[model samples]
Target: MSKMRPSKKELLEGMTPSTVHANEIANVASGELGLEQNDSLTEEEKMRLVCSRFLDIKEDDLMDGDYFFTELDSGKYDEA
Candidate 1:
């Protein structure tokens, strides 16, 4: 029997960056942004919220690749 898929809410609620490495945080945020195609409104919203929190930026300003690389190269994470 196939294992049941977790609900979108469950998947989104489970994402967190609290235990990630400093140098790799931005990459994690970038990867989360790529998961935005979940198709469920709740899932997409949760993904954005978690990604924004992970990046330490406002959700309105989250821009995926360019922003993640910029923040990484600018030593922004170093300040945290």
Candidate 2:
């Protein structure tokens, strides 16, 4: 079946933050950043390295946290 082309407005609206993030992920997976090959590292380890180095986040700041936040800077994100 032929696919219908999305309208310009629809295409513009579809370029959301998530879609931009996905594109970045795809670029990384495609090795556009000239990442070195490390076959010994597991996927989780590789992700950790990437997040700490490229995302400018410290290793100590990495933690298990909420995926969605109500007020991130107000300290309510970690409230029980």
Candidate 3:
């Protein structure tokens, strides 16, 4: 599919805060900027590392809550 481009009108539309947040999520997912890592990784490996780093960052901010995706599970997502 072609990329979704938000127009000036779309950006300046009189949307509620929730709608704006949802739009932001859509923009991020379409050109997402969540996580990244160094070189020497294949495309698949980079994806795994990116997801792992995102989880780690979330855990850092939310230390009071239990992070259920850690390596304690020891499954495919073992690095988290």
Candidate 4:
């Protein structure tokens, strides 16, 4: 018996706002930003660190819910 992976739609539908934000933060922290994983930090803390480093914003602003993340145009989609 083999395990099956979830479909794209299923995966997308299953993600909550926090899950999506965590995934984005992890990717940028590890990949583009080349940040190391800190075991001492919680997911929310890691998110704040990543956003602060990437966007050059203060952690206080993030904690106060003053900033939000958005997907940018990566040229993967055509303008209709």
> In angstroms, how far off is 58's CA in candidate 1?
11
Q: Report lDDT (CA) for all predictions.
A: 0.68, 0.63, 0.60, 0.59
Per-residue CA lDDT of model 4 for 45-79, tens digit only, reads 98997878877666666533322222223433446
Query: For residue 14, what is the lDDT in candidate 3?
Result: 92
The candidate scoring highest on lDDT is 1
Write the number of the candidate with greater TM-score, choosing between 2 and 3: 2
- Candidate 3 local lDDT, residue 77: 62
- Give TM per candidate: 0.21, 0.23, 0.22, 0.24
Model 1: residue 66 alpha-carbon error in angstroms: 1.1
What is candidate 1's TM-score against the reference? 0.21
Tens-digit lDDT string for candidate 1 (3-58): 47679687557456775354764456755766554434575787887788777657
In terms of TM-score, which candidate is stronger, 3 or 4?
A: 4
TM-score of candidate 4 against the unseen true structure: 0.24
The CA lDDT at 22 in model 4 is 67
Q: Which residue pairs in candidate 4 collide?
A: none
24-63 in candidate 2: lDDT tens per residue? 5455654643444455578899899887876766667765
Ten-residue stretch with the least lDDT total in model 1: 34-43
Which candidate gets the maximum TM-score versus the true structure?
4
The residue ranges of model 1 lying beyond 4 angstroms of the native Cα positions read 1-61
Off by over 4 Å in 4: 1-37, 56-80
Off by over 4 Å in 3: 1-38, 56-80
